[model samples]
Target: MSNRLLAIVEVSPEARIACQANGCGHAVYKRIHVVSINGSLQVLGSECFKRLFGGAIGGNPAYSSSDGRRLTDAERRMLQENTAQLVAQLEAEHEAAQDPAREKLQRISQSGIAREASGGPPHRFRAPLPVRQPAAPRRHLGPTPEAIRKYEAQAKIDVRAKFDVDPNLPGWRGLVLQRITELSKSDEVPD
Candidate 1:
């Protein structure tokens, strides 16, 4: 029962849950994930849970709402709808770029949502991924003729690699060069 989750409850719809993970305790909302291990329950805040456990919210059926019943189809649809609403809310809030609901749906779409058992729960609330800081923009080097040539040569090499050019084949170099020349223009090639 030390590291397991026997039960979890939502004390308040608008309140945060205190994380029970080792050493670091913090209040978290938005995505509360609970797990039962070794017959014990732990209420891990979103951050602690993500740092300790790398998995995101799943559609495991073992998890039930406070009412003890699994998610109804309507409830699942509502959750999806809420995600869409969150999108609109984000735009209104001027936070659409960092919308948690959008990120959650992206992750679900990529990894897919799973249920606990064949006949278990339909869907459960999942914690969203931690907010990511945007990466620094790459510096744009002006389109110098050297840069253009370099790009064109790289493209030709890529074409060669993709086709597995056999140097032994008759007219292989001619064919490759012809393709490259056909793709290039006087403006791109420069003087």
Candidate 2:
């Protein structure tokens, strides 16, 4: 005798019916109606329906308490109230998050700087102006060309003095002076 859920009906509080599941005979205001394969109708309570159908009516799972038990009428009402409170709190938080950006856009629209490129009236839909900072001062590294020339000229004088003090020094001393003279005349900067 296979049976399937037909419908869940809500009856008057004064007309409660008894559950028909195996050993449970509790009276209830809401009753589940099921029809057997042989066309027999049966009435069951919420808890009895959960036991017989594994907490589903027509392939849809029924809401139950955290302990897997079906909720009472009082518990269902409390759940709905808590859900409404949470939704209101989330909406308030989202509005608070958007306030700063909205304020900045409003300020830009009020200011005269956000005018249209075509010399028309200022647009209320323009983007906020970019904040620009002043450029930093640049620093110069290494010696200047004039400083290099002055140092090379002084070096030539020092080398000439060394050669005069000892005439037997290596001939590389003259080549060094000649290279210094060539460097001072050229425009290329040393690495």
Candidate 3:
């Protein structure tokens, strides 16, 4: 269970958005929905959100007069195009609102005589942000394919040498033969 509340952000008449929940990465385009969690807003397709939270949510009341159903592919595409245009418009408005010099001039003008007499800009200082160091690279110590093959070849030679010297050596012979057989079958050392 997640301790999260569904706070719908932006709604469009035709657009859909992807779900924000973990492991439920479904694309939702019809009844495009957005929610806020921990003060951060996210766009989610409405149906999946309702399924997870469990409620009958009548999506976007502006289009409620029309039949409540999924959007056709053509409608979805048109809506997506509309949504893109809307997003571009909103971004332009936001950029206009974020003009620092205009905002500062407005603040100074509003302050009137005392600020005008001072002449210098208002005393506002911000500390330099901290720099982050990159992490160290990891070292791999595992044996390489060539090294493994060399070891196996050496093992086979040593085992054969021992067996050739004394083939009837009771305990050693069977074990050496087994090692040689295994070495024949594999190119690398066994774990």
Candidate 4:
């Protein structure tokens, strides 16, 4: 509290600097800023903050209730609303400047000679190029999960059926039978 501007560096807010090199005794709260210049409380900046702080109690980052604690959700929502409004104002300012800038560029282009030719050799024109259009996006195709599972199960059954050893032919191997069945269905492979 002792080092505070309102307490230690009491200066008339109307004047930028006090007549006294140490400090001023006036209580005016407009048109001046107080800074710790040279270890003394001197009016240096603008009093815009002082005048605005009265209405900006809710906007103050240091502001707290009588108990000096953090703000509630309502306070946070208010701050968000205020910030969004300020951003909208700044965006509108940028949007307004674009039109004048384009107009100025257009005027400069019309008056200026865009091309300068130092007569050496005239550039040769190339033959007409074919117009190319962008191709359509590709699509992926695949068997559905149920269909794939069914096909795999069928293949497994075929292997099991062909691999079963027949008692009539003692030399007949199930592996050989399976190979024959696979060769018979060679055309059945999917593209």
Candidate 5:
């Protein structure tokens, strides 16, 4: 009979995570994980057995996929699907092993809001409510629809007097020079 303890070893989806206390197999993908079967973790996949025991597994009785050609598309797809399933299974098992109550509580919390929490309408925004006024006679200097929409939505309320539109207003040159001076003298900035 196979080692009962060895049967429970399982591999994660990326093949890097191993379920069970004894993390075995060379790569994470090859880590044998235990899956419950018939109320016992004694289901050992043949591929994993071959990898672990090699020719000694069956003493060269049956055929070997090791001596086969490249894997077909079907095989590849199956591998991907199996990996995903195994990973999910092993992760669930791991969570059960490590603070199972926390995991269960997390699942319950993610099951959507309770009916008691739905007392009122969902909160939402009602900004710049589209109240299109009647259009006036054509004005040549009017902003393009796209430009007007863009600006309307994100109209810069540049309260900073630095960028004020007045032509004679002082610029940010003083601010820039002060920043440069502070940067040069301060060790606050890292290279």
Candidate 6:
């Protein structure tokens, strides 16, 4: 069985679920559920889960509560608030990191040095070029409708004369008519 971590969930201490990891049958509040290729579930505690999976789950190794008990509502709220604060701090740092490049671009644009070096007018004085529409695609140079009709009519007459069968008739007569039509189509002028 190819065992893999599926989910981590909080369970009530009263449920009394025991870790399935070898040599570790501790009672668990935070249960790590593992599913095998054959669709069997095995539950393990955080410590045992880490040992078995070699810390593949990532994130902080510690459980939500210090003693591995289910967290209180207040503790959950505090954790969320702390997480939000950390995210805001990271975003601020990212903005600060980009400040130098932003400042350089701003300076270049304001000084008009970039425009002068590129031999283009300053931003305010420049006018946009007229958009040239693309030319329509050329079509295949084929026989005109009148020429195609004339060829088909002549072919039908020739087939009827050679095969001694009405081109409109079914069976072998229909095949002759089809061959005549294909020959007429092939007479179209090439591009």
Model 5 misplacement above 4 A: 1-22, 25-51, 54-56, 59-66, 80-191
4 or 6, greater by TM-score: 6
Which pairs clash in model 4? 33-44, 33-45
Positional deviation of residue 14's Cα in model 3 after best superposition, in angstroms:
12
Best by TM-score: 6
Measured with C-alpha atoms, the lDDT of residue 152 in candidate 6 is: 62
Better of 1 and 2 by TM-score: 2
Give the better candidate number (2 or 3) by lDDT.
2
| Candidate 6 regions with alpha-carbon error over 4 angstroms | 1-85, 97-101, 112-125, 128-141, 154-181, 184-191
What's model 3's lDDT at 124? 51
Off by over 4 Å in 2: 35-39, 55-191
Could you tell me the TM-score of candidate 1? 0.26
- Write one digit per residue (lDDT tens) for candidate 6, span 85-186: 433343465578789999998996777977777898766745789999999999877767776666667666777787887776666556655755676667
* 10 residues in a row with least lDDT, candidate 6: 60-69
Candidate 1 per-residue lDDT, tens place, 1-191, comes to 33432222233334444566899767654444455546444556556755875554333313333232222344333333453342233235445445788889887754434444455566666899899999999997655677566646755665578788763357675665564555553334434
1 versus 4: better TM-score goes to: 1
3 against 6, candidate with superior lDDT: 6
Best by lDDT: 6
Give lDDT per model, in order: 0.50, 0.52, 0.51, 0.39, 0.40, 0.56
lDDT of 1 at 58: 39
Kindly list the per-residue Cα lDDT of model 3 for residues 49-121, writing each as its tens digit. 6665554433432222122334455544533455444334434654676788789988766776555567956
lDDT of 3 at 30: 49
Candidate 5 achieves a global lDDT of: 0.40
Candidate 4's residue-wise lDDT over 44-132, tens digit each? 22343344344433332211212222223443233234533432343465467677998997866544433324444444457989989
Q: How do all models score by TM-score?
A: 0.26, 0.28, 0.24, 0.20, 0.18, 0.32
